[model samples]
Target: MVEPFRVVDLADWTRGESEPGGAEEKRWFTAPDASSQSGRWLFKPRRIKELTLSRQRRARGDAPDLLVRGEDWAEKISYELARLVSVPAVETELATVVRRGTEEAVLGSMSRDMRPERWGWTPGAALLAEHDDDFDSELSRGHSLSAVLTVLAPMNGPVGTEFHSWPAFDVFAGYLVFDALVANTDRHAHNWGVLQNPTTGVVCLSPSFDHGSALASGNGDVFRADRVRSGAVQQWCSRGVTKRFDGGVAVGLVDIAMQALSLASADARRYRRDRIVGLNLDLCDDVINAAPNLSDHTRTFVQIAVATNRRRLIDALH
Candidate 1:
């Protein structure tokens, strides 16, 4: 049996107000550990599969007490997967949030802030809006591949790190490949962006973040069990689509990933293709097996989905 992941309690950390954007509830907090190098972390609680009612409750100032899905585990797992595949991604940890002066703890995941000193994070939506005056960030109609590539063409890879030698679009292609492997359907215009320094005016692609929507996180155990038992897991994986990239374009996850690869340089195409083709299933199994509180059915479902998607992506690339 794999060992469980460590969960940090945020009761003692200095809590701040909630951060803006995204559908889930999130809050900013400063890590209290003096030994820790990271300064700020964003905590996102495991969201309920059904978010309409949760939104209503939040509007009414009530905390949701309904069934929370496995997004927290999905996030941590996605982080490990991205790291394994050499994708630039944010670091995430499983944690519990205990309100100040309260004993009850809320289960969630915390992502360390990746912004460098004197740099600000900007989402793709804002950049796209500026790139094209007619572009609407909230809608999927104008979030085209051509527009996104045009915005990233002139930028460099992530700053602060000398290891990244690729340009922004090349790295962005890797992000799409990672999304295809994990079936992350939430890579909307707002999900990705660039980091810019105000003083020197340097900009680069930001590491991939917000993967809670991946690996079938929103589905219930019954649905996963049924698909696994019925031997229809591949069917479900094939149906996975990223609606955020589709206005009426109607592209499958693998198709979109391949499209990005085609637009990328030969070096980037070879790099991402080699990574996908060389991905080890056993190591991926270790990631799935180690996720905290993941049911047997869910684990099996994720394994099959990833393996299926990997095959599909490889076939598409070939």
Candidate 2:
């Protein structure tokens, strides 16, 4: 049996916050790192504690900017993505549930004074406080196509000193593959990247982090609809092959992912064929079950999409 999830209490963070963990009290915070808000870590606390936790939630959204308030739900989502779908997403933990004796000032205290129109999340961070200055945003950071390619390349461990490029293209191919199986559509430019360790000559892709928005289509309001669509989805839903997502040509990671999905239909071969079947079977269950947020049309589209793209990928691979 699945263990009952515990609601995180705000008082766990500090004193003064009074709300219980029932209504608004059941919230997790994404503390803004000096880098990017997207880079923020998930902190599950109720009342008041660190000021860092307070600034994490914006006053305007009623909803969190990106971080989901309920840590329990978010953790499960991340786990399913990683374990079932094989996506290299974030490692989430149950930080702590502080049952503080204080009143509910944690909410009021952290409320921002910004205008509703002015409120927004910071997508990119110039630097991670613990890391070196070079990682920080400069005009140099967003300019080069090679620079974008470097994110997939292996770099130094943390400080990002060494330049050991990873089998970036392959890893990216893996991610695109896994994400497609799960019907995940949150692979925006901001969510994907590597946290380089300059010390070691290792450029590991940041574990495929942040997929809370993977199945959420309400995002059509905040972001571009196709921003997260798979190339296959784009092909079926939006007219034809899109260079924006598939890199235009029938190749690379997107192609590989689509083919993996198509393998579900084959009745021959032994090992590789079975692996594809398992992946497809798992993908169908996970996406259909966990995706309560998606519409019937959208979900069905994903189903057909995987098969269609699978065939596309197979043809390309052959």
Candidate 3:
């Protein structure tokens, strides 16, 4: 079982503040372009000097800041599960905020700015632009997975080395497997990217982030309960499709994973198969159960959904 690196109760951060001030203030400039109904704010806490110092030392940058999302817990759970499977994922914690004198708890995930002084970050969209002149329009119309693969497959090698000799393709394939297992439908162009070392010009796939849409985040408690009671978890999971690839075609997540796996080189396919087969579901259960703040109904639903998806993925490999 994987334990969260940290679990913060936000009440500590908001205790004395009568209103949103000090560290509770939002940094409006850092918001990324995405469709999230929940309000997001870049929070820099004043009390956690240790956290701030650690983030700065690791990234060789400033203090670590949190991207807090109101009324959302999916990111926290998703981060935990991703870490459990040894996938690169952002760290997250549950927090309570006092806004307008009303106390509410939300999920706050940590982020290291990709734009360090010496390094740079590139979104998948920019990477795709290297290959397709009409990348933007093509992306808007959907079915752009092939275009993305075309760009990423070639970046598999070490800097100044043979491009075809590396495992970057396999690493990305592993991400698809993670998405399928979690039923993440939002692996959009902007969601994945590469971290580039400006000094060396060496680029590697970025760690997975922005997973607020995974694990049926949009489903209500009542709907999730109904599905669980009816034993329709598998059917429901199968019906989970991604909007990232198909604008309106309703392409299933598992189908997308299968397609990506098939397109991958033999070595990449074998790597993904071994990784997925080796994941520990019991550890996943422990992580889910450890989230005391999560509602029982939601927890139960997540447990069943993960189990169903794991079986579905294992079956797909055969």
Candidate 4:
């Protein structure tokens, strides 16, 4: 079963003027470096007198601030599905905000700032630079999955002694499997990273985030309904391609997973495959069924699309 996420009715909060005290007084941080294509704002809720209550509402454990992005509900659904399958993902919530005096419900995903005063995180692109001198020039031409794997594989073995014992490689491989299952096409270099523990000197892969691009988020209800009614759901799955690698080349999401699996070590491969096998489609259906304000046509389309993609992923594993 998937864990329940806290849903905040921003409309009610705004109307009641009961939004967290001092929310208006708090300074919002700018995030120009964030890779999200949508607008993002950094928010920190004022600490409540009750400690337990404060922790519960906090985005991540002990982190006082969260990066809030304006997104479609796809990120919320993707985050829920990721949790259902036990994949590490950032926590998200559904919120309604008044924009220009017009109220609209929007999906807001909050990520804890990994840089907590001392600890620092490194983006995949920066990590890749340590291995290849021509990283920037090559990226300007086209980024390929093969190139990424080639750089990351060394961390798993005798060559990169610094990360030989770390679980970064395995975690990254699992992320690729999750992305494949969700048809996420935006796993760009800046989207993933590794966090360093300032006190313990330990390093690990960061939990996955920025998934608004997945699940055909750009598709409208009309397009999805037409595809479902025409029985072209399979065609839609086949047409789903990743925006990363080879200059956003059009390649099937499953194919990307297969390639990533092939490049992974035996242990990494097993980890990814096990996670994929553990996916609960029934829970997925329940999630779709419980989605708030979803149209019947969209619900049906999402169900079919998820089922088709799940089958394709499982079949590829075999």
Best-matching candidate per lDDT: 1
TM-score of each: 0.91, 0.42, 0.71, 0.70
Question: Candidate 1: what lDDT?
Answer: 0.85
Q: Is candidate 2 or candidate 4 better by lDDT?
A: 4
Pairs with backbone N, CA or C atoms under 3 Å apart (clashes), candidate 1: none
Could you give the candidate ranking by TM-score, starting with the highest?
A: 1, 3, 4, 2
* 1 versus 2: better lDDT goes to: 1
Q: In candidate 3, how many clashes are counted?
A: 1
Clashes of each: 0, 34, 1, 1
Per-model lDDT: 0.85, 0.37, 0.63, 0.61
Model 4 per-residue lDDT tens digits across residues 1-318 = 434454443332212122232223222233333323122332322122222437566645564533222234567788788887666776555543443344433344433333445777777777766766666623433356666665555343211223246445565666777887777877877777666668876656667776766766556566677887898878888788775666556777888778877766787676667666777778888877765666777778777877788788888988
lDDT of 1 at 42: 91
93-191 per-residue lDDT for model 1 (tens digits): 998986546756778888988797768998998888888887876677678888889998889888755425777888898889999999998888989
Query: How much lDDT does candidate 2 score?
Result: 0.37
Among all windows of ten consecutive residues in candidate 2, which has the lowest summed lDDT?
107-116
lDDT of 3 by residue, 181-277 (tens): 8888878777788878787787777767766667776565566678878878778888888767744456777888888888778876776677677
Residue 261 local lDDT, model 4: 74
Candidate 3 structure lDDT: 0.63
Error of 2 at 212 (Å): 2.4
Candidate 3 TM-score, C-alpha based? 0.71
Question: Which candidate has the top score in TM-score?
Answer: 1
Q: What TM-score, to 2 decimals, does candidate 4 have?
A: 0.70
